[model samples]
Target chain A: MKKIFDFIDLNAEIQWVIVIILIILITATLTFQIWKKVKPSNLVDEMMLRTKSWWGMCFIFLFASLVHPIVTYLGLAFLSFFTLREIYTLLKLRDSDRTVLLACYLSIPFQYYFAFQGWYTMFLIFIPVFLFIIIPFLLVLSGDTTDIISSMCILPTSLMLGVFGISHLGLLISFPEMNTGNISGKALLLFLIFITEANDIMQFICGKIFGKHKILPNVSPNKTWEGFIGGVICSMIIGYFMGFLTPLETLPLILISACIAILGFMGDAIISAVKRDFGVKDMSDVIPGHGGYLDRIDSLSTTSSPFFHLIYFLLLA
Target chain B: MKKLILTLIYTVFWRSFNKIIIGLKYHNHKSLRKKKQFILIANHNSHMDTMAIMSAMPSKYIHRVHPIAASDFFGGTKLNKFLMKYLVNAILIPRKKANSDKDIDPIEVISKLLNKGRSVILYPEGSRGTPGVMSNFKKGIGYLIQKHPEIDVIPVYLDGIYKTLPKGTSIILPYNCNIIFGKKIDFHSLEIDDIVLKSEESIQKLIKRE
Candidate 1:
């Protein structure tokens, strides 16, 4: 239990996170009250609901980060399960794909289990290599030849995004810290999430305020070059200062922030492309106004993997 | 004792299981809010279809709701009869008669139950069909509605039940199921053909899938 406590960093850095969250929650609640009195649009209620959920998310994350490392891992595993369920729910799966879907759902727990064990080698390739071989073999055994190729194509990509991609965030906290600067697991995980999510919110706000020219009009019409630049600039500045929470130097943090900005956009765009292909406005209404977990974490699905690898290469590796 | 077991199976056990499988997407549950008795007509594909609908009914109304089960199948054996009687509160309607047995009239039984202010469940298809495909409506439902013109019919579409637990298979897959209850149909004059066609058509619209 003490070792678990040692792994978690409830230091000045995390204290700052709690303060910031409190400020944001208070400000959001006040704004909701004021906006309800002044000019309440349907959008106001939606924004209010988003803020409410954000408070829930922030507190739960803080508690998990403070309690033990295992909670964070299991929390992420739970998120991946819901996200995977959302993906499969929207997909018009064939009868042949039933076994494959079940296999994909089962892979989530195994991936996180590996993450918990700190089996980096197995965690990195479990879904892509292990489940990749196992699923197709199971499909062949089922004797349903129809829709096999498409099932093979969709299953791996969805699992990679829904299971493998999201589980990296859990793995991030479990990675061994280097002795050079002694950056704690909770602080690093919090920092990565902060930058990635801040980038998302900043982009949406900037896009709504000043966005005119569409970056990818066909794919994500809401995205604009103005919003993109603004989000990158804001996120980079935050990432540069958040170096205190991480072991990386300013230059490396800057580079990582840039990667998060571009990759986050690309990640979000790729999921937008998927939603477009499926002709769904959002994945599902699991998160009330925010659609589903997939809708909220589309950027995280892309950002977490590369960010973890970058940290690994720079410090721990 | 009978109602207790029936409520336990339908309300607690099957409801939880179906909720896990599909989250049991129930639509127009507002239609079930009224205290007035109405017959529920649904498309039958899997055995789970009945429970799926029963689970969605409010607890206040569930005690008064009785499902009309096929007597030949559900009442064929002693154990099957016990389960159907207690677990489902099923009022068995004979589909086929034995050599020595008399032809049981389902219309008489259904009318008697409806007159007693009890809501009944009926499958217009008479039996479970291939999941995702609807069979032609039998005259049994038409006869019931024609006889009891005062009882409104609630058309329900049990989507994905076939995929979850198709006919001739006991293996229950965890496929998501949706129960959509359409508006109650109260035909003015008693016409079996008109009531059956309209009831079938109403349930068809509730199905979003092909």
Candidate 2:
């Protein structure tokens, strides 16, 4: 045991610094949780729950980074499973939705399998070409044989939001231009989540304080024009600072952050529409004072699905 | 254990939000609050009837409540899987009857949940029958109460379930089912063979509204 500890990299200075900083942060968070003003809230509670998830996610990603890049990607794929589960729960699915549901469920494991095997072409084809084309017909199989709307809308909507829209996050594995930064994709994954979540919290706080005019009360009542305006500005600033801290370039980072926040709101809105129709609160109650599986990932369900591909298309292409 | 808690929490959120729109009620809730550890038999009028019993029960009891969902229907789909795993905490048992000589039985599972300090909800008159009328119950309740003499065999009627979301309707109608808890049956005096007959008679008597 002594010899095992000896060969271990006990001499790494950076590891010690990371350990100390993490200890301090954990201590502070526990102290805040105990003494901070804990109120029953629709919004603030959502913010803290998300922040806890971010901490958990960071540890998972960092831990995975030690093993292999494929393992890190697999860890991310598991995250996608729960995230997709959340999205699937929010939307209503007809019996015909099963084939596509199978396809959508199959996409995560398959994409990660590609990332695991280092098969870039199959991974790229799986979501866009395969999932995009197949899901709509899976809707048709629902045999709404006469009325095209249910087959058209419900089936395609879930797969696009669940599968096709978010395929590009996996595409990051082979993304060539991004390699120049040398920051692991897991780090970028963490970065995306942090900025997106921070934007959500800031928007809620800004909206609560200064919100007067409703942005689209029909779709989402809690959202406001002021909140949207304030959230984007704060997100851009936060993204800029993050870019500087990571030593990544500036203008693009700010633009990406703004994009995540704006798109995150759209995702939140779509999920809200689902809950409203179902007459249910939060997707499920997995978290204390929070709703179900879907509620936790409404943003990712909406944002990442589309955002990943858009980034690959715009930047990589 | 984690699955049960998650289901209870999921159901609580759903009930709170659904109550805002569905508009449901339970009469004489105070008498029903104190009781625990029972084989609850209820009329299966609609899907909402299940939700009514779930929402009306206290959270602690709700945690212990295991609805005996039919495997053919409840186990067959992803949505049902989510609901069974994370919303209802339901125990899906096969509905098919065992052969005459077969030793393996479905009652064994129900008997187990009762032993583990949990209450089991069994719709004795299997299948969602027509709303507002009593369907003929099978001998399963009689068989169960006879076998597990310790568990309280409580009779419950979901008063408004027929209209809440009536049978054969695909869409969930905007209606609330009110649950009425009748008296619990005492089987301490009965013999082994007499147990089945007595329990069946007791359930019939309790189903009648005064």
TM-scores for all candidates: the values are 0.86, 0.58
Which pairs in model 2 have colliding backbones? A86-A294, A165-A305, A165-A306, A166-A305, A283-A292, A284-A291, A284-A292, B7-B86
Summarize candidate 2's per-residue lDDT along A1-52 as a digit string, tens digits. Answer: 1222345552232243335437745864675565447554545455556557
| Predictions' DockQ, in order | 0.28, 0.06
How many pairs collide in each candidate, listed in order?
Answer: 0, 8
Q: Taking the tens digit of each residue's C-alpha lDDT, what string does model 1 give over A45-151? A: 98889888888778887887678778887778877877777777678777666766777777877899998877889998898898888888888887888878777
For residue A271, model 2's alpha carbon misses the true position, in angstroms, by 1.8
> Each candidate's lDDT (Cα)?
0.79, 0.64
TM-score of 2: 0.58
Give one digit per residue, the lDDT tens place, for model 2 in B1-210: 754564455446646634543434455545656877777777787777777766666665677878888888888888878878666778888787667756346788888888898888888778887657767776777667777877777777676556545665454433333467767777755454565555556556655652
Mark the regions of model 2 whose C-alpha exceeds 4 Å error after superposition: A1-71, A83-92, A96-100, A115-125, A138-148, A165-167, A174-177, A180-183, A244-248, A305-317, B1-123, B127-149, B152-210
Cand. 2 Cα-lDDT: 0.64
Candidate 1 runs further than 4 Å off: A1-11, A32-45, A59-74, A176-181, B28-37, B60-64, B71-79, B96-101, B115-117, B133-136, B159-163, B166-177, B201-210
